[model samples]
Target: MTDHLNVVLHPLVQHKLTLMRKKDTSTGVFRQLLREISQLLAYEITVNLPMTSRTIETPMTEMEAPMLAGKKLALISILRAGNGLMDGVLELIPSARVGFVGLYRDEETLQPVQYYFKVPDSLKDRLVIAVDPMLATGNSSVAAIDLLKKAGATNIRFLCLLAAPEGVARMKEAHPDVPIVTAALDERLDEKGYIVPGLGDAGDRLFGTK
Candidate 1:
C-alpha cells in the first residue's frame, strides 16, 4: 500500500481538531468547528480540479475567464456523519451535484451493510468527491467507493474529518488511486476499534445522540 495519504496538517486544523477532541466541547461548538475545518480542508482538496476558459462580458470588455471544466461536480455523502461534512463542503461548492450513501453496521458480522445508495448521472464524466466524517475501519468508505465506481465514477476523491492508520491502510489496499484528504492522521484504534485519542463517534457528536 502506498503511503500517499494527503493529510492536512495545517496548524489551524490541528488546533480546531484538538478542541474537537476534548469531550467538553459543546455540540454547537463542535458542529461549527467541524464546518470551519472542513471548509479549509476543502480548499486544499479541490486545488487541482480542472478548469476551462469561457468567454464572458466583464465590467469593461468581453474577456475569457477560467471556470470549472467538464461535467458538473458531484458530492456523494456517505450518509449520517458524512452529511455534517457535506454541509460545509456544499457551502463552498454550492453548485456541485449531491448524492447519498446510507449504510448501517450489522451487529453479527460487524460489517457495513448498505441500506441505501443513489447518485447523479454521468458520474464518470464529473469530478466526484465522496465525503464521510470518520475513517474508522474503512469498511464503509471502501463500500461507498465501490458503489460510486459501479455507478460510473472514474475520477474520485475521498474527504474526511479524521482518519486512523488502520483505515488509511485499508483504503490504500482497496483504492490506491483515489486521493484521501483529511484533517488529521490519528493514532491507532483501541479495543472497541475507535481511534485512540480520537473524538468519539462523529455521528453522535454531530447529532446530539448517544
Candidate 2:
C-alpha cells in the first residue's frame, strides 16, 4: 500500500477479479463476482476505523468489547456502476447511510457532467466511503469527491474494483487526502478511456447493455 493507495492482492480478490475480466462471463456471474469482491475490498478499507469500548453481557458476566465509534458511516455511490459495489459494502456495514452521485463523461470533452447529486446529512461527522466499480478516466471520481467535500465530508475514502495508473495519478493529484482502495491497478487506459485488461464497461456489464 502506498501513502494514498492500497492495491488489494488477496487471493480471493484476485480470483474473483480474474473471473470478472473474462469477456465471456455472463452478466449474472459478473454481477455476483463484483459483489463478492466489493465485500473483500470493503474489509480492507475499513481496517482502522475508530473504535470504542462498550460494556456488554456476553453470557454470564459483563465485559467490555470494542465497538465502532462515531455516527453511522456514509456511503456514496457514484451512479449506475457504483450501485453494484455499494450493495456488497452495505451487506457488511448495514447501518451505513447511503447516498448517490450521478455523473456521465462527455466523449468529446472527456469531462464529467453531473446530472444528479444527493447525500446524507451530517457528512462531516461520519466516515464516508465512495464506491465506483472502475476508475478509468478519474474525471467523474474526482468531480464526485469535489462535490462530497463541498458537502462537508472530511474523512473520505475511494473504493473501486479496478483502477488505471492514469486514474490513480489523477486522483492523487486532485485529492491527495482521500485514500484509495482497489482490487487491481491495471496497466493503463485505452484511447477510449477504458482501463486496458479491465472488465469492460462496468455499468454495461452489470446491466447487460451495449
Candidate 3:
C-alpha cells in the first residue's frame, strides 16, 4: 500500500461491501456486514506494525516469541458512523485504546462543525487509526485529523468503509502523511455531497435513522 491510500479488494470484503451498497439491505444486516468488513480492513492496515520478540515457555520448551512492539494502538472513531467500524476493529485488537471525534455538517456551508472530541493520552507514542464508515466529502475527516494533530498525534492512519474520488483527493491534499485504508473507492460525490454508488448516509443507515 502506498503512503497515500490502500483500497482493500479482498473477495470477502468486496462481497460484504456489495451487500452494504444495496438499497434494500436492512439496518441490522448492514451493521453486521460493516463489522465483518472492518475486521478485514484492520488486517490490511496493520500489516507493517513493528514487531518484537520475547522469551516464553511453551508446553514443550522455552523459546522466543514474537509480540507487537511499542505502545498499544489508539483507535479514534470519527463519530456515530465510525462506531460501526470501531466495534469490529476493537474485537481484533481488544487491548487498543479508544477515542472519539464527533462532527456534524453545517447545512448552509456544508462545512464540518465539531461537537465532541476526546482521545487517549500519549497519542504521539501510539499508532492512531481514525475510523469513519464513509469518506464522503472528507470535510469531517480532515477536521478530525486536525484535532488529532493538535492533540500531539503524529502517527495516524484513516480507516473507512468506502471513499469517493473527491474525498480521497481532499484528504491527500490536506494530510498526505496519513494513509487511507478503505474497502472500495467509488466514482464521485453527487450534488448533495453523498457518495455516488455509495451506501447512503452511513450513520443514518447504521442507526435506522432518516
Cα lDDT computed for each candidate against the true fold = 0.89, 0.96, 0.94
Per-residue accuracy of model 3 over 38-86 as CA lDDT, tens digit each? 9999999999999999999999999999999999999999988999999
Error of 3 at 120 (Å): 0.3
Model 3 lDDT, full chain set = 0.94
Per-residue CA lDDT of model 2 for 101-183, tens digit only, reads 99998998889999999999999999999999999989999999999999999999999999999999999999999999999
Give the least accurate 10-residue stretch of model 2, judged by summed lDDT.
191-200
Clashing pairs in 2: none
Q: TM-score for all predictions? A: 0.95, 0.99, 0.98
Better structure of 2 and 3 per lDDT: 2
What TM-score does structure 3 among the candidates reach? Answer: 0.98
Runs in model 1 lying further than 4 Å from the true structure:
1-3
Q: State each candidate's clash count.
A: 0, 0, 0
The clash number for model 3 is 0
